[model samples]
Target: MSSFCLSKLDHPDLAWLAADRAVAADDDPTRTAAATIAVAQALRALGHHHLALTAALAAADPADDDTVRGTLHLQAGLAAAEHGDRRNAHDLLDHAAALADRHTGDTDPHHTGFGAAAVQTARSLAAHRLGDTAEAILRHEHVIRSDGWRRLPPEHRAAHLVDATRAYLDTGRPSRAGRALLDADRTAPAEVRSRPVGRTLLTEIIRGGPAAADVARLATVVGLTR
Candidate 1:
């Protein structure tokens, strides 16, 4: 969990160290698989997309718990997308979706948060990473419209909103990007203020000219001036 938080906080090196310690401490296959998810996240943060994908795929055990295995596939899919393997990325995500169908509820057992909504959210991010901004926005819209979206953790929603902000920006929609950033801030202030990615996105939105009033205020709150 520390590793996961560290990764979210944009401290990939520290996250990697923590994930390594977790792997060393866990002997159970399922536990180790969970730890490997953190490892893959850290590696992805470090720009080692291929290694991250390989680690996630290797750690996935079908016999393990559904959440853990599905989460592993999700990580692998994201990594694959980042590594430019579009087919493999969607394939892995499809596999995760199938696993999610077997596992109902919005439970976060083992902190995996593996379920249908999570998978759909992952698809949005995967599409974004693959340079399909239109597809990313479409998936994001669908995810948020679903009942499962509201049930996700605040941090998760905020993080996805930040990514969605970027997608909007990429598609020449700064106003929409501003709105998404505001939504992210409302969902989780720390996700906007503490995460480097969020902060950077905020900076981009502000510098792009004529930011929303709320966005400008948020910049001030985060100690980022125009």
Candidate 2:
């Protein structure tokens, strides 16, 4: 999953190359499907949203594993949302939710991280990407209220918080965004200090003026000074 990790690190071009190598090395249907997840992620990172959606959808068909299939649907849903296909995005998310219902607690078979909570978080992210800030914030609040929230991996929770930060910022809630970023840092310091998305959001919050003390400290920690 080097490709997937690379994409998460914002190295889309390297991720794409790694994904290609993964696909070339694996011919197994399930393994190929797993690699396709990385492919879709890299494609999305590169702004090839439509192609990412198509690749995820195609990969889902051959994915016999529930976790892999569900994860593909989530990827497809996010790509569709980024591509501005609202209906398709919602449809794919709903389909992923249905698949998630079959599984019990948060399972990470194939490292897909597909489960009820993951689907819920994906909904929040899709909503945010679709310009539905109200829905995004609502879903995000619902996610944190659920028992599955704490059950998620620190990285997953932290990344979702970063996305939630964007939703809060969109609604002109800089303090809420600041709180989210703080939560993200508390959850996984690297998520805020290392990831480009988190760093950019933190910069935005700082530039908006009058940040909280903790936020200002975090800015300094991340080498971002006002």
Candidate 3:
């Protein structure tokens, strides 16, 4: 269900289904935390920032395992950023970073990227949301070039690159955005094609006027043929 929702982000109904299942299996903190984070991300994609934050907060468990704590805090921070609460977002993200550093750094558990790189990516996204475009770009660039990036799961790696695409878009660099999106798509078409942000970024690139051949090719690959 999560895969379907993630791959077909144009369809929010699927996300709703995944969110419900995640909430239903609430007996396990690890499962609950991961699901809640996924729900929060889906809610964010659906433009329900408040609901997303609420969902992410539900993932919190001060006594849970390191992965759960770090994942929940990261999700909460991301949703907080989307909710326009920069201070809370930074605090939560910083906490998440500390937890991740003490745990596994940047590793994927339950297919959710939770750790140092995830914290940094969330921080970059928060920075972008809060209008610190240059910082977002720089942070994202470093992540993209690091060994950590190479170690990330394909979809996870793609998601971070797509975030970088937003930084470029903010700075009026359609060509750069185009390249970044294409790079992500090359890594994981399911991640890029199924993501709301991916679709929107591609739309923006298309609207920004003549994209390069590689970008155009990626648009077709991702089914953004319009």
Candidate 4:
């Protein structure tokens, strides 16, 4: 049997990609910052909380007060959300959003929506878990329209699409969820495609028993190995 797993969910390649890009673009501080965020997000996704925290801290700029502080808070908020600390997560996320708003008029590109979509998405998940369906739906809808997803690297964009797909599913809108899953599947590479397909299949499973041929087809498309 193959030792590789489709559900393993590690992001070593993303970390490597980010690090390589950061090194190659050392002259561009904004690219470096963005790469740092990517590294942090990848680490966070892979359950390396300490590494993610360290990366976030390292990404902070001592000179640029507002933007740097906001970025750090946003990173911290993401970590907090991952750890299930909703209250602190929301507080830090809101703080980051406010800070971002304050720096929006600045010409610097780094002052943009730094992790706000992730924060809102986390909040939406929390709200859903807490049975606050309306708030969850509203937050997810807002995040779906946000520039954060559009601004992300293509891989991260696919990942966010998966997240957004789940958000739609949690709102009991299976059709919209399926569409989001399809989008993610279309954009994702062979190695990453299965996650979205698995999610889509779960809906099918819930409704009734999905055909083995259908499941096998999706597995083939997704390359069921990690």
Q: Is candidate 1 or candidate 4 better by TM-score?
A: 1
lDDT of 2 by residue, 138-166 (tens): 99999999977887788889999999999
Better of 1 and 4 by lDDT: 1
- What's model 4's TM-score? 0.58
Q: List the residue pairs that clash in candidate 2.
A: none
TM-score (all chains, Cα) for each model: 0.95, 0.95, 0.84, 0.58
Model 2's number of clashes is 0
For candidate 3, the 10 contiguous residues with the lowest summed lDDT are 1-10
Kindly list the per-residue Cα lDDT of model 1 for residues 62-133, writing each as its tens digit: 337888999899999999999889999999999999999988765656876678888999999999999998
Please report how far candidate 3 places residue 13 from its true position, in Å.
Answer: 4.7
lDDT of each: 0.90, 0.90, 0.76, 0.57
Query: Candidate 1: lDDT of 119?
Result: 95
Residue 211, candidate 1: Cα error in Å is 1.5
For residue 89, give model 4's deviation from the true position in Å.
1.1
Q: State in Å the error of residue 143, model 3.
A: 1.2
The better-scoring model by lDDT among 1 and 3 is: 1
* Candidate 1: regions farther than 4 A off: 105-107
Q: How accurate is candidate 4 locally (lDDT)?
A: 0.57
State candidate 2's TM-score.
0.95
Cα lDDT tens digits, model 4, 149-182, are 5654455456655665566666666666556556
The CA lDDT at 34 in model 3 is: 68
